[model samples]
Target: MKKHMKLFSFLLALTVTASSAGCSLSGKKNSSTSSSVLSEDDEGNEGSADGAKADEKKTDGDIRPQDDFYGYVNYATLKDAEIPYGQYGTSVFMDESDESPSEKIVKEIGKSDKKYAPGTNEQLIHDIYAQAISYKDDGTAEKEIMANCDRILNAGNISELMSVYGDLTLNYGSPSIFQFEVMHDYKDSSRYAMYLYPMQSFLGTSLESIHDEISKCEAPNNIARDMFRIQGDDYDTADEKGRQMVYIGMDIANNTDFEGANDMGHLLALEKTSFEEFDSIFSNLDVSLIDVFCADAKSRADGLYVIDRGQCEKINELFTDENLDKWKAYIYSTYISSMGYFIPDSSEILSDYFPKSKEAEDDQAASVVLNYLSKQVSEIYTERYYTPELDKGIHDMFDEIIGSYRELIANADWLSADTRKALRKKLDGIKLITAPEPHKVNAKDAKLVGSSLYESDKALTRKVMDDKLELLSSPMDRMKAMMLSTDVNAQYLPCNTINVTVAIMQPPMFDPKGDHAANLGGLGTVMGHEIGHAFDSNCINFSPEGKYDPSWLGEEDKKILDERADVLTDYYSKYTIMEVFHVDGKLTNGENYADLSGVECVTNILDDKEELKKLFESYAKTWCSLSVDSSGIERLKTDEHSPEKIRVNAVLASNKKFNEVYDIKEGDGMYVAPEERVSRW
Candidate 1:
């Protein structure tokens, strides 16, 4: 049986009302935190339960609320929760307790019999769903896929194959040897810029994250061989080609800083050069890389923001006649592996050909087809599942959190007058965007027309690329800028706005009929968690104007802020998973800081002890998770956020008010001394 709160007066206490906060939690300081987790989801970005998708989920042993708030409140839920297949973990926010939101959306759309008009959203939505579920293994699908691959990679020389890299990238969703993106400039975050990085290899890039070193180097060869076989190459030829692609891919992976990509300093450490100068990085070749950087982006190229100069130059060494077969094999392997789905029985072929390679690939997702119909699916979701009242309630909660944040910053003792004013300014400017963004979903002329899913997807890919390129010349349009509706996440965009994604507005995260405390603990705290990020060690530097500045904090203020955050870093650093690896507090401090402030911001607005109890339970429920022994161990070694239990316990430990409500004493596992507490915001 589930345990009850300490006192019988708990019911009476729940009746007491409390004020609300106008703040929220947030993402990584420089990038985005996974949106699905209570704070950071990791398994293919599922609300991260961390590592091994448990064959058998494990909840914590019996623990008193005063001793272990996270365990005490979440243990019951975790005991019964099941981790879905292919997902690393599950939580109250996005669980397997009911039908998957994505599957539900797909099924609802697929069930429609009425034919939608071509170019219309309804028609596009239906077609996307139908095509995704159409697992055509017929010879025609494979032929079309092979024909496309051969067309793109059928060049005689290295330069020829390299020339249409843009075409391959823009028209087809093939993973390239190099990744190109139109994004906010490193120095000038205000305007869009074209960024390029040497393609990190399929080996060690996904399925497994490469840390300090790369292991199982030959794994790529096996994968490439399997890919070639499934794509119709003979074993002897496949063996030879697999070896060749691994050779080329290894050269790229060696020089690429995959680990550094996670660091803010490394991310902002961009190398800019003109088109010609950038092209020169590919020495000894007549090829103009700028020509292959995609066409629509050519005119809008502010400058090439090369992320890995060494890797670019290093890969250039491979662009030679001597390595023509190597280049061809590498190109073929990547294209086939990524675009192989066009072939009917692609999944089955891969399973028989190379089952392990299929594990982490995006094409295996059940609602993978829905990605093509994002705008349409979102529109449908809003029409059927959302309400104006829900929208208003979310907006109202955000408003309350914002009010709470204003007071938190206004009263922060360590912050100087200047910093306080600036923080408040950012808080004041923070906007809340709910589901079905304020802007329209689709373009008037945008239409997908193709006999096959592959052909139709080609059109969609080009449209998406064109849309991204158009942003290069345009200022950040916050209205048009939103996360996918199907993603169960809430993000505080670096632009100082909070996104209460439609997917997160469901149960365990938020409910329209939930009592004030439940809402406060669920969605209210999420908003506050995002808003509270402004006070994190790194986010404190985000300008009200929406740019990241390393030097935003004045020297004196910076020192004070670091001193304050150091407490959090030290407190969290003490935590370990399996007692083998410790949490990287320095790497995770920004998120930890946000988690603490997220709670502090929400708790400050509510005063009733009974209501506070409910709010606290709701908050912990969001992070409820079951896992195997190896679960948090891998995450602690790799991820930037604290483990889920740490995210809950550490923050709750620092929550004096919560401690008081539960009558937690110093001996309690959940208690921290007053001086040791670190609620900086």
Candidate 2:
């Protein structure tokens, strides 16, 4: 199996528009462009539901534009839109135009007879496409993965067990028993440090959930049974193996340290120390599968960091001959999952294990090539579909928004001088990078061979790991990308960078020919939201250059900031989804505040009445969705984002420009009275 990276993005890591916003899925909208700005009520009844419904709208929908902005603009599109087969929800992010360069590139490369020099990107692109078509799922990849599993089971002693785990890490580019990586030091961005991460859980991540889910073990058991059954084991034997792995997973989960090892809260919870401290902390624990600590491999450099002593303690307790078979079964379980879920469709080779919808069936081949060499594919996409005008226009708008933030901070009477300085520093340091920078990867640079897709993927993993490890000795390259240069996503990485990729820079989210109001409302708001992460409740602890520094703000200033943030938490908590679940204010504090601040930032740039209408509509339209109501209910309960309706209504309601432009009065559903408003920056 190819190695998977553990990502770390701060509170507003995944932008709501840049993504499907984690199940707040979207659908296509064909809204009428006619004017729908709110007209004054004729009758004396204000704030009445009847009055709201009577408001004029450009398109037909039951919602009043002022009351439910998201619904008014997107209701028709979402109501009529059908969720495609096998998709849990619908999203605008999923709407790829027919002319998208990714699929075109795949077909073009696959059909090309032109050859390039060895180790060239052109060669890799051509080879990757060929391999995607040549892939054989005939259990070969599974057996290859299982060989590592067998090594774990056959180990006679701790040394041999440790040896296999090391080979898995450094040689085959697989997840190690003790995962470690050399990356930039968060406290000081100039140098890199080796970080020893915590044990990953199989099912549940919470300690209490471990006792609940693992105790039942139904999910993991089914996974094991289904995998075994697909691999030709009898149902009875498969069922037994399933139960055994669950029991093993149960033991592993019990030992997992799950207090604060997540993307949302790592900076506040994780500790850093010297290499000697790391060694001393674990010396008595009897187990430390240190990074690249395989028996025969040599580990260079001395900088090392550990999450805490608890990690080594857990590993020591778990590594024993008595638990060897349990370890093998647990590891083998991952192979079953990979082979079953991601196995290639085969007319003769790898069996297509499950049935898929026609939509997915059509995307299978191109999807394979896209997933196989995503970064390179991103390069191809930019080369074929690069729009310089839109790119420059968006960047110019981003700069204006950053200036607005600066002006807002400088004028904030409540903020102290030190807070203002730190914020301004962060604004200055925020760098924008176009992912898979157009033509940066020369056609003759990166290389891959004419092997199976499985092997080619493994080789690609090694290339990524090679670059990651090389960074330990190299200077911090702020321009180097940390997140996937995905086709339709934007991310705020801890490296103090806002990465905007290829496809997302195009239609729906942005347009070169579109008016400034619409473009700013759509993509500018998204960019501001990412910048807002730098000063949110959680991320404000980090320094200007993205280094963690909780003490940067004065005690008095922090207290005032907390009070301001409290208003958002309380405000959003009152909102409900599916008419049953209430949004968790504290859980969504960072994101809600980001939404409010993001809109405020973008709204600061333009003042025309007509422009404001277009801006607000574009903002609402960007999040238009037809998600399964059940999914929205769950996301409202657990997701950091407010549901789509609340995301539009609540966010716009707080904006002074929105209220002024829409003529939202005291009793209007979209009006938040002056005293009750929350302005968090």
Candidate 3:
């Protein structure tokens, strides 16, 4: 799957808009007009001037004077306009005010008395519960719910369950596992039917089965299960508990086939035990010493043991003498104090795993040690350096684009005075946040010890769980913090806040010095697209305060909006992917609205400046880069946004300016009959 596909249609609250102070770039004395702008000396041969004139005749009667320049473009270029050539510069930095049309719409919606349907996921749960409740027999609902829960809980053997849970806990941690429970009020008729709850609640009921499975499994580091057993056994030595723990860790580390001494080496050093060791072990049939050594070592210290060769090879691959020396000093200062999770604390044992060289306490040796330590520390560290720069650039770009929109708003002749006033009100409520909040996850804040991998793992897990619980309990606050974090890709809150941080402000989206058209087509379109989301059917009912109300428009107005949306849906449905038809009209309605409206808004903004319109079209060409991926083709079937070709073609078709600039004829692919064209603000 494409990494960014998930983000393709999603709304991000992270967008920053232009200032509300009525800022105008056009008012700047330094800004130049198209007539004075420089131009390339490329030939401009009109192939079918007669055909264009004939086509123009058809729409002449219906064309309003104001609409004549709706998509006009001035091909002139300017010498000092900061136009980029070839691949533009990588980093762009700017500071600007935040103003946006989407924010205004959201704010106006907030004041309205529109009702909101539950989120899709929430609605699914509600529907399931309602179905369960509809049965006349009270036991029927309860029984069905229990049956489904039991099936999920008991689908595999106890050992399999343990393995699955252990893997899940290790990788995703408990919060993700919490997604498997069933909760029901049984009292509230509205919501008492069937709802999913956290999975932790079921662990208690199946603890015995789980333990039995763990006992049967030969692998090591069923980490949580092992810890649970040790705790339950009261740290008993009589049962050889320490040995069992060591065996578990070894089993986990050595399961794969790779060149390492044992499992410990495999897990920590990313190596596997040599085939010779396996052969020798099978022939000797004496594994007691290995088991005892592992167990006793684990009791006092947490050591990630692997064949020395594995660690040696990895060290060679990653470090050089100079780099190693710096790392050694850093590691001793940072991680040497905390070694309980992985290696035994006894000096003799510690020296066996990590020996201190007395010779010069030399930088070379220190470097080696430091290199190893850095690798260990990096596992938990999370910091992105480029986020701030990207955040600043995106915000500046958004501000400029939104400022252009204000001009369009001022010039819109189709909207009624009352509607325009409401539109302005909506624009006023848009909120912008630049970077991710400081409170977001950071490795520096997490206290991790390299000596004991187990201890470090447990500590990290606990920290993450605590964090998740906090987020779940106070979702709004979490959302706020996320918006502030510069590392977050993008976010859009039901609230009017549009947040665009540094994480997603890079690459194909927004390049600081790329062709003006490409940059705008990428991030600029994305910004406008998200803002348009605020006016989707579901969002339209909500007021700026994030409350569901329907006060913004009357029933007749809503019907008109719905009709317009239907037209969009029907039009997009004609597009095909992988031989499958377009997305369900209702399912994709929101994204469709955003696409259409976003294009209209951005295009209108560009129309205010003929030269800018040309620049914008040039930028849009980049978005048309095609891919051969079948899945991408298949996406057209269920994706709300049309293919790039269709998006550009359809939007441009309705653009009178585009027609004039391109000299489109009556039968052109992008031609839209005047009466058939639809317009909505």
Candidate 4:
């Protein structure tokens, strides 16, 4: 799967009314406690003093309320309630005594003949299960495994593969496809087995090399040091480093300049020139010294590795003029809709004047919009929950989770001693990139000079790419240029130098006062989800030293994980939006895994008795919202993440900790069978 799979959304909750008479005791309140022993009457009957039921009445089994104020509930409160009860609430729509909102939606969708109509929900659900089962049983599994291996094996060339033979041996062969083996063991153990690999091995160099270079240089005290060199600073001071950093930052900013204003005299002349002319200029340049320095810098970053000229050329080859335009459209749309970065939609102009032979402009437009929306949601979350102080808290939570795995490793009855030792080493080598690295573009110092929007954008893109290329050449160091800017809205780049740029920090995604549930539901989930990617199925195959190693878990444990994932795929497949829902369970499985796991991880931390319940309530409030539009609904079909409603339902369903809080019972509609639940840490 692409690194794009790392981004996603989160949960839902119920409204809190002041009236005691109208409120359903079985709703939000029941899930808030650890005790699950409650009767149907106990479930309902909680209204505020105002006499209005806190739990709004359901119609056609849809728990969503008619009133806009009661439309969507909070995630934190829902989690608080569910964490103790193990269900949404005693009276959730998914309960056996009640039909789920989705089931009702399925019934409604069934009435429509349009492929994308609302009635196809049930079929969509059924199809996802069928597909998942097929993926597991058909030759698809082998094909997928092989394809991934090929991607890695062919990343650079045969020489690179030979250098990482031990790593390749574990994952490359038809018979010894190591990822499958790990999955097999997880299936048997009901526990996750991850194989950690180093990013350097695949990229053909080590991040350590890059890190050493950065260490030799001083750190910058402010953004200026990164932009230009200054005197009187320590060798390791930020000011000295700032000069190189500024150059890279300016390069990216300039490339992004869509307007023509930033174009230099020479660049203008080259713009109208042929590709051959451009190539000539590039070839004549003495970039070797810069490349060497960049390579050194990348080594210092710890997790990043250089993508050699050969690989860069290959990636470049993948970009045709048409594809480049599509990519630009996607980026622009993502900025506008998701990141809330205000950019004019020139689709009208493109559609009217740009030749249709250019590409599928409509598809590009939609994708761009979707990316923007996703990013917008992410920013909302970052603004609400991300802070320097909270960083340590989050890290500590991760440590505790890791500690649990340690205990599990020690006591596992099935694993052989050899496997255990290997697992321990993998655990020890887990590489974590918290927050952005300190060595990215210094936006403050970078000036855009393009005269036209298009020119500026192109210039900025090229500049950014060059800066990144420079970093890739250097050793690994965490770059926070992206994170420090409140304007950045998304993240990408899979190597050791994790890049979180400023483009990801924008609105709809990051409103300080936006409802907590929605903010976290958007960006918080995304951030945590991305962090989870560091240890996702694909990343887990490598070792911390950037080498490929197949020593994470034993065979038995891998099986358990597959079966568990199967359950998730099966369950999500059952969800339908209009009758024509397209839940691509196989394609989305990795994201689903991350979403589920992130919720579990975050919930474990938030559920502590010592934590204030109100904070949980605030978190729950984030997921609350009004209904979406037809276009928004249509987009859900192709989306990798589950719809908001299901995101809450599926996660809470499998959370045993939630069951304890909600008093959810076996055979309840929202209940997940114990044997069917998937747990990966």
* Candidate number of the best TM-score: 1
Per-residue lDDT tens digits for candidate 1, residues 154-213, read 777777777755567667777776677776664555667787754655643441333234
Q: Model 3: runs farther than 4 Å from truth?
A: 1-393, 404-419, 440-446, 450-455, 478-491, 511-518, 577-580, 583-585, 607-630, 633-638
| TM-score of candidate 4 against the unseen true structure | 0.41
Q: In model 1, what is the error at residue 294, expressed in angstroms? A: 1.2
The TM-score values for the models, in the order shown, are 0.83, 0.81, 0.46, 0.41
TM-score of 3: 0.46
- lDDT by residue for model 2 (130-218), tens: 66555556777667765665676577765566666566656555544455677667666556766776666553333335555655577
Which ten residues in a row are the worst by lDDT in model 3?
A: 11-20
lDDT of 4 at 172: 23
**Top candidate by lDDT:** 1
Candidate 1 overall Cα lDDT vs. reference?
0.64
